[model samples]
Target: MGEVGWNEWLSMMSSLAVVLVLLGATLFGLKKMGLSRTKDATKNLNVSEVHNLGPRQKLIVITINNEQVLLGVTPQAINRLGNWPEQEAVDDLNQSIDINQLEPDFESPSDSPGKFQQLMSQVAKRTAERKKH
Candidate 1:
């Protein structure tokens, strides 16, 4: 009985090893055939953003090969809406902002020149009043 049990245990281990080997080979084959998710396959393609427009519709921004693509996607289909060079998009964004507008004028009253400063001052006053009460 002891010898029989030892043989059965050895047989089960061998079968398990064979199954693991087959599984590993199958995974390797799938990866080589490009049917498995692999980093090399998507190294240059990136989904930058996704915005849901409805329950079944979305706007997707994807970057591929140094170009940005805008896609409109729904349950039924995916459509390319537009595309632009990534560098051109960066340049356009930089050109849209004026450096001078972002600088706060120090000579003016603390609250007069910038809305952010004014809002901060109002917040400070409210907090001071709250502390007094």
Candidate 2:
């Protein structure tokens, strides 16, 4: 700032100090008012009452082979099978027929390939090798 008369400088400084004090007081007041709502919200927060399970809910009740399973399932197990994208049920249905006879066939990644396609791949490899030479 440029040098001003002492009286003008003091007056300008006083005005600036007043503005800073007013701003601080307004901010403090807003924070004080906001605390009431914050306290009210805290009082209204939801609390899940996780207590002892009842008779039916205690067991995971799944019938695998005309018999019910008495073991309780974890939340992680339920979360894992929640989504069924693609033809996953088809996999279960496809394996249902040969469950006892060929259990090895199920869950195995298919390795079958067309004969002509394999021969074409070999020809392409030979052509690439000739180009390299």
Candidate 3:
């Protein structure tokens, strides 16, 4: 509550700097250990769809090592629901089957970038092309 003197202000700022450095080091360590939630998801284990049964229960379809497996996840544990047939030549751009038909319980939208983002990128590309021309 009282006004801080010059020395006290410098001491407080130094302490804050130390705390921030330690926090940054801890976050870097966590990222290196693959514990950061913001870390990119595993390339081999890709989530194809998710069905939320309740607040705590969900059925997830994840493609692991080219095989899709249905998983039932709860607060307690995760169980295998079933296995899906292997897809052929499927990519982010090309999908043969309708994702909605695969799961009736929940509507699974495509994971491709949103239409607005795509349109903006296209506009930017055309503008750059026009500038170059």
Q: How does each model score on lDDT?
A: 0.60, 0.38, 0.57
TM-score of each: 0.42, 0.27, 0.41
Specify the highest-lDDT model's number. 1
RMSD of 2: 23.8
Candidate that beats the other on TM-score, 1 or 2, i.e. the better one = 1
Residue 97 error, candidate 2, Å: 65
Q: Please, what are the lDDT tens digits per residue for candidate 1 over residues 1-133?
A: 3456878889999999999999999999988887855446448888987765446555677889999886766555576766778876565334332223334334433232244333334433443454455
Error of 1 at 103 (Å): 36
lDDT-based ranking, best first?
Answer: 1, 3, 2
lDDT of each residue in 1-133, candidate 3, tens digit only: 8988999999999999999999999999998888966666656777887766446656667888888776666665576645645563243214322323332322322222242233323433443454455
List, in order, the clash count of every candidate structure.
0, 0, 0
Would you list the clashing residue pairs of candidate 3?
Answer: none
Which residue pairs in candidate 1 have backbone atoms (N, alpha carbon, C) closer than 3 angstroms, thus clashing? none
The reply for model 3, stretches above 4 Å from the true place, is: 1-42, 88-133
